[model samples]
Target: MTFNFLSPVSDEVLAHNELLTPQALGKKLKIHSKAHGLPDLDNVKIAIIGVLENRNDINYMGSEVELDSIRKVFYNLFPGNWYTNVADLGDILKGDAVGDTYFALRTTITILLEKKIIPVILGGSQDLTYPNYRAYDSICPMVNVVSVDSNFDLGDSTLPIKNNSYLGKIILEQPYNLFNYSTIGYQTYFNSQEEIDLMEKLYFEAYRLGEVSKSISLVEPVMRDAHIVSVDLKAIKASEVSKEQKYSPNGLDGKEICAIARYAGISNKVSSFGVYEYQHSKDDHITAMLVAQIIWYFIEGVNCRVSENVLSDSVNYQKYNVLIDDDELIFYKSKKTGRWWIEIPFLPDVNNKLKKHTLLPCMHEDYLEATQGKIPERWYKAYKKNSF
Candidate 1:
């Protein structure tokens, strides 16, 4: 069926589906683009699927109504033809069981992947990542995931499939080696000792709020190796949220959230991205605005990478050397003079092996540090004669 955000669904379809009529669905929202002009769906490399289902037993606020509101808010915030190519694959059919909902989402992602479209899923719960990742598994040999959340999401499966425990289920089912997963902005309150222990055992990299600001650089490298990104809204502090089921007095501010989104967009390896658990019912205009901005940043990042030829061979092979020291690891770019020079003041913390080694697509100094330098050390030297 023809999809138009500005127009309503056809009467026959609405009647058959018992869905909201165009008028009742609310006004058409528009968002302006800063760079790519209007979106061209035919040329769309990114496809966003909004999953409104909240079937889980979690304490999440809002429901299908909030999902509709979020759609409108996004329309208004990103008015124009910015994502002309980015089609809204539309909402998944509502389901009674969490498994049922996840099934529909999984099917949608599978179809999108077949079409070679980058899926941007507006989440129902963190569990959504399971299917999103599953879709990638069918096509990609390996899938890397980056989770921005306050909890480890590695809770025991005894708990019902709800918002908080889905990620854990995904980890249990998916191969750990296939995932270059990292959890960011986690809080001590949301995780249990057992859960934390489980994460450590799994070798899952985590960064607390205090470390997030310092570790912002870690995002790119984590994303560099990733095939998909799963962002949980709860990772942002409650202070930054307009409305939330477990709204905290504090969370990642808007700026930090957007920067992370941008980082995801710029990572050429990220074939799909999803954001979950944004409760629109309790959200004020400000929260809606922030959510819209986050989505916009994702769009911007995609456009930036696409245009910068990030995926192109010329840009893809550009190398950065990562060096590790006792205190911190540094990144250096090889100069034509055959000397290593510090392009940025910061160095990505990388594995000891990456020192004096070469990295692809140039490493983000911050991500190298955050991942603790998974890159080989031979590509990076701790002591260069020109060390800054």
Candidate 2:
């Protein structure tokens, strides 16, 4: 079992946990430690797993990746008024080979998915997202991925898998389960024009940093439709993280990133969440606290999730129809949550990947735009992807 590959939380962290206030999350969580083998996962809503593999990082030198700092901070902080049970499964130590580590992570995440427990992954490098995405292969037929990143990371699929190029592997690899991929807070200058053009050509979604920061709520719908939400810490601005952790001067702030994490947690479709690109440094306290708060807010959002009877009953939602450019567009709004969804027309001629997800999550603005005879870009992209 891949769980056997997992090492217990360090005695140091456990000792620190004992000193934390009773109200702290450390006291509330079912922790995996030397004393306790594995926590009973019954009714457990979330599982935290730390990955200690960063050799895949293109800039790798021979340094080790440690997650104890983040764990110490996260456990010391107080949780919100949450009823959902959380478990810290400790860390997945690096294996004999990078592929071995990926296998361990992939199997672990797959088991967690089968049990209907969300795996909140604290990862060393962003490439671990490939395994996270792979874990969904057996659980779901089609998957939507949302990345909170500054670059597309669609490097050469022809090359070996690395943090910057893992997306290409996900795209070209067998089974072709990726239905849609969306990126939030992407910096235009960081991405090559070819990659940007490829994103548009493939009908994938990419939101710029300024646009998302201007209105953080814009990510709600995008996140609502996502199955795997991967966040890269490098997407955060230099001012928000430690000196060694900063990869860009222009990126999302701490608040913006946390808000995005909350949105990801609130999404019913989002089953796996990961924050990657963590670098241990002498002054990592700020970054650790920020990451901890991000996790906390995610838990709070999950607890606050409102179950909206989206398409079951007509009485539960209000339906609207708009004619744009001689084509009829259908939209539905949940009366209970006031959330909107635009229907993706079924293409009988083509094998559709989104048949189960016919009602694509959207915003009120999308309906208003359609009413004005303008096709919302998201709707257009979905429609095009479905047609192909």
Question: Best by lDDT, which number?
Answer: 2
Cα lDDT computed for each candidate against the true fold: 0.60, 0.92
lDDT of 1: 0.60
Sequence-dependent TM-score of model 1: 0.70
Those runs of model 1 whose alpha carbons end farther than 4 Å from true positions after fitting are 1-41, 60-65, 78-84, 174-177, 243-246, 306-388
Model 1 clashes, total count: 49
The local lDDT score (0 to 100) that residue 190 gets in candidate 1 is 77
Model 2, 1-388: lDDT tens digits are: 4477788999999999999999999999999989879989999999999999999999999988988999999999988889999999999999999999999999999999999999999988999999999988899988999999998999999999999999999999998999999999999999999999999999999999999999999999999999999999999999999988988888999889899989988988889999999998875799999999999988888897888766778888999999987788999999888899988888777876655548889999989888888998998999899887
TM-score per model over all chains:
0.70, 0.98
Q: Show the lowest summed lDDT stretch of 10 residues, model 1.
A: 24-33
